[model samples]
Target: MRITPDTLEIGSTQKRNKNETLETFLKRITHVSLVGKAIVLMENLNFCKNLNVLYLYDNKITYITGLECCRNLTRLYLQNNAIEEITGLDVGLDRLNVLHLHNNRIRRITGLHLLPSLEHLKLDNQRLDPGEQLEFDGECLLALASSLRYLTLTNNHIKDISPLEKLKSLESLDLAVNSIQDVEPLESLLSACSYLSNVNVLGNPVANAGPPVKLRQRLILASPTLTCLNEKDIPQVERMFVENMRHAQRSRRSAKDHNHTRDQTTSLGVSGTAGVATPACQEEKPFPHLPPFASQYRDLMLSQLTKNTATERRLSDSNLHISPRKVASAAEALHRD
Candidate 1:
């Protein structure tokens, strides 16, 4: 393959020395699409310290460890790679703001906690799932707590977002297709981040969401300065809900008092009218059966006698202790006598 000077690509500056640094060559190459595992070697790209940006997309690179040498790297695109974990990134890359780690197999969000200068981060379409959620504490949110303003967490397994409350400066939080069920976890966060104005929670089931208000609506209604991109999406305020809550509480209190009163009355045996009050023992004969023709007259006459017997029973204090058989036998003997 012989090429003339006229056919040669311009800006092909080569060193006169036989041992030219790979950093010098890498420096010359502004954007390189690293193809199938050819080992894009910049073993010691020490001279490329001034390199501001590097795009290593679609490479078979399994790890991100050796990049600690790239101290001055400001923008790095490592999207669509075979990387499983993001480890070796140095905090020295303070100027690094944008990182594209979309379309990777990265499981946990552990090492990236130190990227304080990062502003825009994309972890979309990754292998994150509900069970494989970022089992993180507030430290991860605190890491990007201040510096991050924009974030895309679409298609991840993030469930509880209680950790995001510390991202006080976040403006755009795209959590479209995550497994977040409760919005209260993000409530304190929404209240804290005054800069936050847009929240994408469309794809998530409305049932899993927390509160009567959606994320966007809650932020707008709560914050005087916050406004949703679409105001119509805000839910309507139902006065019935407030009334129902108040009524429920009142009913519960009334029911408790009623039960307490019933228990007290039952305990005191003051149950009126229905109570069986036993009277004193009396030597009264059972009344004789009257003729059938005079039955009506006998009934009228016996009504008064029955009332008197009931009154006597009520007056007696210990009648409940006397056996019914003894009372019946005594009444028969009295009648016979």
Candidate 2:
């Protein structure tokens, strides 16, 4: 059987190899769009039976019905096809390991369990709107979970991925834009899959749910191998933590400020006594009146009292308003006083 010329069409490289066998033709050709008619001709030639790899992406095929004849097929590239359903794939292709169905219209995954050897599966652009159905869509995912090691379901409508725990062998999983919020799923992943090393939840609510530092800490504790986490979207948590520390420092500052004010007030009172003392005799009667020192003492006492009162009022304010700078300033002020 001779592989057709139309099936080998690729850019200016569309020249046909008339002498090649059907199997050689399919194997040599790559990056060609296999439309429905070309696929039918290939199916009729029975040439795909011995084929180990097939590139049928960017095609007009609506279903996976044509690939049943290629039983020995190990890698199938059917990306950018018009296929809507994922059923009826059980066939002679038991050796199939890598299936790239990216950019397909597949709404549901139904017949994926048949390929027990499947190691890496990409349904990234299927737009699977698994409404209400939280976990794997029935047995298909269950079978995959049993053998699948790497899976990418990015750019889909998948919401609750807690079901991924079923994939005991999964090592790398990409669920970037899902609607999951809680970090509870991490626990399940850690418990079920001991080898899980990487997880990308960058654009989801879970990323923005908590403090980045704290979240990073918790994730590190959960999986020491977890090298990356994307919780930076939660700016509020970061801000809140900063605000809390600022408030604490402010409080300490106010306390210091109050103490400083108190010391200044006491010093002023003692200094004022210097001018009011008698001539080392009859001092008990009290010196006549206010000297410059006494005036200075009075002004100093009033300023100290005012500062102390202001500091107390500020300390009583909400802890949210305090800042680190204020605390340091207060400490310095207390030292000077």
Candidate 3:
């Protein structure tokens, strides 16, 4: 019944007691590191019943094997290896919480539903081509949806994330440097996964569509419950302000469009004006009995009108002077004198 936690380092030499059996070694070691040994197959690991953490990264392991008997395994690091498919992990490692399989050849996500306690699953840069998208098995994801919370799929060429809609318990998700082009899937995620508050979608096509402020506003509006986006916290007041600004902008744009359409219609109706005097034309005509000065200053007024047409003149009280008619009368009097 005496249990002692100890770490065993099996270096490149793979040296061990010549007479020690695998069962005896397994019963003694709680952590093991066989990193960078060019090991291909995962053998001699079944006897590690007390093994809680195993690091086998930077090797040539083609498939996931060994450790089938390590029921107490909690953390397994198999990153930077040659794991093409995610298999061979069964119910034995049910207690596994952190599993790092990044830099491998895993094209499809599978064989992970067996780990009911898995929380963090890292699978970034899984040997995918420049534009190739990573695929996932729906059933496998649904199985992990309840327990898996922190998941990283960076640089995986993932475009569609509909399969993650069932991850209601997921809290933090990293999809940075991916090929995602739409934010609709993330909106669905926010609606489905209530606990998902932190999300990273940087370096994606969707994030580059607009300015940072506009993109952040769109994301916040899409997911009001989000507390963190692209590593930045979304304060409550900021969220409210962004939403209000978006609403106001939409209203202004709609009003401008409506006014423009109305003006176009009015212009079309008043196109032909040979005998028809439009209201605008009638309003500009001078009164008949304004004296001979009105006719004399008509050319000056027309010149002023032509100049004003190029730009809008802001009329203020400070700029007001004698009426145009009075000015015209004074000029005529001066000429007569």
Tens-digit lDDT string for candidate 2 (190-294) = 667766677777676777887756555455456544544552332445445655666788899999999999886665454534445546543343223444544
Alpha-carbon runs more than 4 Å astray in model 2: 1-45, 128-135, 228-337
| Regions of candidate 3 where Cα sits further than 4 Å from its true position | 1-25, 246-337
Q: Estimate each model's TM-score.
A: 0.56, 0.56, 0.67
> What TM-score would you give candidate 3 relative to the actual structure?
0.67
* Total backbone collisions, model 2: 2
lDDT string for model 1 (14-116, tens) is 3323574543454443333333333333233333455566666666666774456567677787777777777777547777889988888887666777776
Q: Provide the global lDDT of candidate 1 against the true structure.
A: 0.60
C-alpha positional error of residue 205 in candidate 1 after TM-score superposition, expressed in Å: 1.8
Best by TM-score: 3
lDDT of 3 by residue, 241-308 (tens): 99889899999999999989877655544442334565873333343454565556655665675476
In the predicted model 1, the residue pairs found to clash are 129-157, 181-208, 279-313, 280-316
Better of 1 and 2 by lDDT: 2
Write the candidate numbers in order of decreasing lDDT: 3, 2, 1
Cα error, residue 213 of model 3, in Å, equals 1.7
Model 1 stretches astray by more than 4 angstroms: 1-47, 207-216, 229-337
